[model samples]
Target chain A: MARIVGSIMSTHVPSIAGAMSRHAEGEPYWKPFFDGYEPVRAWLDEVRPDVAVVVHNDHGLNFFLDKMPTFAVGCAPQYLHADEGWGIPEVEPFPGDPQLSWHLVESLIGEEFDLTTCQEMLVDHAVTNPMQLCWPDPDDRAAIRIVPVTVNTVMFPYPSARRCYALGEAIGRAITSYDAEEDLKVVLMGTGGLSHQLEGRRAGFINKEFDLRFLESLTEEPAWATQYSGEDLVRLTGSQGVELLMWLTARAALLGGARKVTSNYHIPISNTAAGTVVLEPAA
Target chain B: MGTGTTRHEIPGTTIFDGAEAQKGYALNKMCFSFNDGTNRAAFLDDEEAYCHRYGLSDDQTKAIRDRDVLRLLELGGHPYYLAKFAGIFRLDVQDLGALQTGLSKEEFQARLVAAGR
Candidate 1:
């Protein structure tokens, strides 16, 4: 049976990629951010998860406003680079694990989690930025398989934090029920958040305290984390707080009482808290 | 070739009024800012300066500028951003037109929902 070896929650600020590229050699603005993820990079190296089920939100890529699915799972063999304006820089197209993705989708729906499946989809920075950051490619790195899941946080009346959490629990159940005989270790990665507004006069505001508390709740008391509605979150932490649902979902997928392996928090990441936390099942 | 007279006589010709055009400009500006690292950095450095440079109003300069989205739908009618805007506002497609195009919102949403959008 497939087992979830661990879960990771990381903020998907597009600048993270820019930071990594700049910091790989060493740049001032991004050095601190890159430093924070070193431990996370080490953990990923040590665990060496076979597949990563990434949960993120698309910024109008794939299922644009015409029809936004609350949760869409990628069942495609490969996903193309989205022309999200200027487009991605020097990155290879992402490879998808359709078999495992479909299995998880079927298993989740069978477990009562309604999932919208996509055969062809393009992923935006939300998925790519974190992937580039967490798994910086080696000289001849083996490709890492991905199962991309999207949440509807881009639109209003988005699924509540509770719903995302429930989906995560369902994902955990789905993975647990997989009939595969291989020693599959999957990593549940939640990308997006720790407080920065993307719109209006309050656009560049950052709530450091709220971000810290959110990271605390995410690791120590995730159940309490889902009580906040999107509106409540926006009011407290600006509209970007909506991304917190991704973290809650990651938390829900973990085995209860997992040990947090690495936690890092940095502020003013181009006007946001670039926070990350990795949790692993208790040994 | 189509006659200029017929094109000029098209109804809703004034749909792209000054306000509507401004909204489209704002939306494009935001899209540009999102795409360009230098622009985004300048905007982050000083929002007021960025707005002044872009020639956008204070309301037009907000971070999550959905008004521009609404305006783009009104003027140009790009389904891509409209769909996203509709999803963002949770506004039914039909209702969006009825509200902006003088159609009944319910009927518009119904048509869109029926069309599988």
Candidate 2:
């Protein structure tokens, strides 16, 4: 049977790509953010997950307004990164775990959560940046395969925190029940926010109070955030900041309560509040 | 609540719901095209023609021509797709933030950093 080793909730701000491309991690402005990953890298070295189930939202790189699905899973053998029109150099393609993706799709649908399954999907910065953050070395990245699970955070009418949590539970059920030849170690990755908006007059909005509380809730009281409505989340976290739904879903995927391993928070990572948290299932 | 029935207002923010989507379709369509280098180059070559091809509303066209970030949002532009449009002019989110808030880039950045403390 396959098993989830742990889960990672991270910020996928696009500008982080430029900072990395310039190798500016040691620069004064980016040092704090980069330094946060040290412990995360150490944890990864210890756990050594064979596959990563990345839960993120696409930022206009794959699905568009033409047709949007509330939830989509990629079953492609290879997922490529493309130009986001912002001139950030595209990263290498991610090798996909199609078998696990299909298993997730079948189990999730069986669990009554309808999802769109794609055999071809273009991964945007949201997927690419965090992958790079986790495995800074290409060789380390090569060892792990990926299964991309995207939620509709780019537009309004988003799935509720509670609904996303339930989806995560279904994902956990699927992964735990997956019958495979070898025992597979999987890491659940939730990539997005910690309060920051980028539109209207509140373009640079960052709610530290809400972010800290939300971060605390992830482990201390996992479902604490599900109490708020989508509008409430946007009002409290900012438009793009509401991307924390990704965090909730990933956290919920841990069958048992989670134990916080390491966490980091910083402001104004390219008009967004950037954060990262690692949680392993409680023993 | 996940139910999509009710609507609530968030000051200084526009929820890109169904109505906003309908209103900004053409403008966002044009912006989404920027994901391709050739389309970005074509838009740079003739902004008006590209806007015309996308059937952008006169207001949206003027907003795009003026590079008015706030006006584009008012005209129903989503930040995600509008970002690609901003890319054509080499504007990052910080630049967009400054423009929308009527602050200098440095001032806007300072405001963000201050949010942490």
Candidate 3:
């Protein structure tokens, strides 16, 4: 069976990519956010999972309001990042595991989660930013293919906290049952949130207190998150912060328990609070 | 938690639900097309013609012409997609927020900094 060795939760902000390309090593404004990802990069090297399942939301790049799916998984053999206007520096395509992708698609549907299967997609920075943060060096990209599981955070009815956690439970089951013969190490990722409203009068709002508590609960009392309502999330978190449902889904996949290996939180990475926490199954 | 058909009534924000989705389809589609650089340039070259090409309603066309962020939101223009439309006018999110909240650009930026506190 494929072993879900670990998981990562992060804020996939687009400006972080600009900071990276500009080599903001010594710049005070950018260094903290970049520094925050340092340990995350080290952890990726240490665990070196064979593949990563990226859970993220598309920001009007791949899916517009026309036909946004509540949940979609990239089934292509290779996924490329698209130019999301204003020329965010491009990167090489992320390798994908099509066979494993199809397996999960069939299995998840059987598990009663009908996910839209995408054969071709231009992944936006919502997924790529966190990917680059975890795996900074190109040399490290080898051996770690990606399977993108995108959620609809742009429009509602987003997958609820309960449904998200349940999706993770389903993912945990799917990974264990598939490819029992192969010795595969998998890393699951859920990216987005930690508060900060992007639109309306309350733009740039961040809840550090609520955000930190969420990190604590995500690692310790994940089941408690299921009770969060749309209003509760919107009231506490920003409108965009509701995207934390993505993390709950990933946390649910780990099932029983996990230990947070690293945690990083920084304020206002271009109008959003940025955070990352790496978890490994408890010993 | 169902399909985004649920109605939400936030004090100052439009939820971009099914009804707004229908209302803003043409305008949003036009904005979404700005992902392609060529479309962005074409829209810049002749915005009125471009709006008409997409069959946008008079309100949406007026909103685009006026660079009115709040009006666009009221007309069902999604903030994320409308951002592309705003980008054509070189207005960033902070600038747009400045317009909606009646703050100067500098004041809006200051408020953003204060929000992190």
Candidate 4:
């Protein structure tokens, strides 16, 4: 049986790449964001998940406005990171576990969630940043494999919050049922906002109140988080904050309940508030 | 591609939904090309020729000429792809914030700091 070891929710703000590449450790402006992921490294050490079901959104790298899917799961043998403009140095290709990726595609389809399955494509910052943050060292990254799940947060009319929740549930069911040798341990990771808009007059908007409330609701009353509409999401959190819905999928995967391990929230990571949470199943 | 849009009732935000994706396809394709440095230089060298090469509609051509974020949004330019176009002009997405809010860049930066407070 496949076992979901835990879930890690994070912010994939691209600038972190520059900060890390530039060795911004001692720099006060970038320290908090870098420091924020320290615990994730420890947690990854402790959990040692066999695979990560990384849920992230694209930034016009893979699917242009041309053919964006509501949800896409990559089943390729390897997914290379792309130069997201400004030429962020490409990292080594992320290893993929096709068996599990296919398992998810088959199971999710059986559960009535139509997801685009990609055999070939490169991932952008959203997926790579979290990996870089949690396991910053290259050798550490090679130890584990990934099943990249891309969500639609870039374009408008997001997958309803309820649907995101249900999708998580389906993902949970799928992972728990995959008959793998030696009981594969899994980690479900969700990336994107806490608050802070990237466009429009209301841009630069960071509702820390709403960000905290969102984190609280997601960690506690997850069902209630599902009740929010897209407008309400934007009204409460900001335009980009609607990306929090991606977190719902991971929250739903915690077979028991989100036994919050630890969480961090910080503001102004290039026009966004960054948040991270580590959740394990309650006894 | 935009057909699966969840339903956009968010006011003041023109979502790049399926209809918008279909409408702004050519414009976005042009912007997406900006991911390559040479392509960006090409656009900078001959903006009209670049737009024409991508089969940009007249409105999109005008929007590119004007560097109008709002007009591009009206033309179905998805925020992410549009950011690439804005990048060519050395304008970050935050620049769009200042542009939309009718504030200076520092003023916009202050507003972001203010909101967090």
Name the fnat for model 1: 0.06
Ranked by TM-score, top first = 2, 3, 4, 1
Report the C-alpha lDDT of model 4 over A42-154, residue by residue, as the tens digit. Answer: 88888899899998888888987657799999999999886666556678888999999999999999999999999987898888888988888998898789999988887
* Per-prediction fnat: 0.06, 0.82, 0.36, 0.54
**Model 2 alpha-carbon miss at residue A96, Å:** 0.5
In model 2, the clashing pairs are: none
User: A153-232 in candidate 3: lDDT tens per residue?
Assistant: 77655778888888888888888788746688889999898787767777656788888888899777987768887667
Compose the digit string of candidate 1's lDDT tens values, residues A64-174. 444668899999987776445433353567778888998988888887777889999888778888887788883212367788999987555578888888899888888
Worst 10 residues of 2 chain A by lDDT: A265-274
The list of candidate 4 runs beyond 4 A from truth reads B1-11
Worst 10 residues of 1 chain B by lDDT: B1-10
Is candidate 1 or 2 superior in TM-score?
Answer: 2
Runs with alpha carbons beyond 4 Å of true place in candidate 1: A23-25, A87-90, A138-142, B1-117
Off by over 4 Å in 3: B1-8
Write down the TM-score for model 1: 0.72
lDDT at A72, model 4: 93
lDDT (Cα) of model 3: 0.81
Q: Is candidate 1 or candidate 4 better by TM-score?
A: 4
Q: What are the TM values for chain B, all candidates?
A: 0.37, 0.93, 0.87, 0.88
lDDT of each: 0.67, 0.91, 0.81, 0.83
Candidate 4 residue-wise lDDT, B1-117, digit = tens: 446536646556655556887898899898899988889899889999999999999999998899888778888787788888876676766678889778898888787767666
Query: What TM-scores do the predictions have?
Result: 0.72, 0.98, 0.94, 0.93
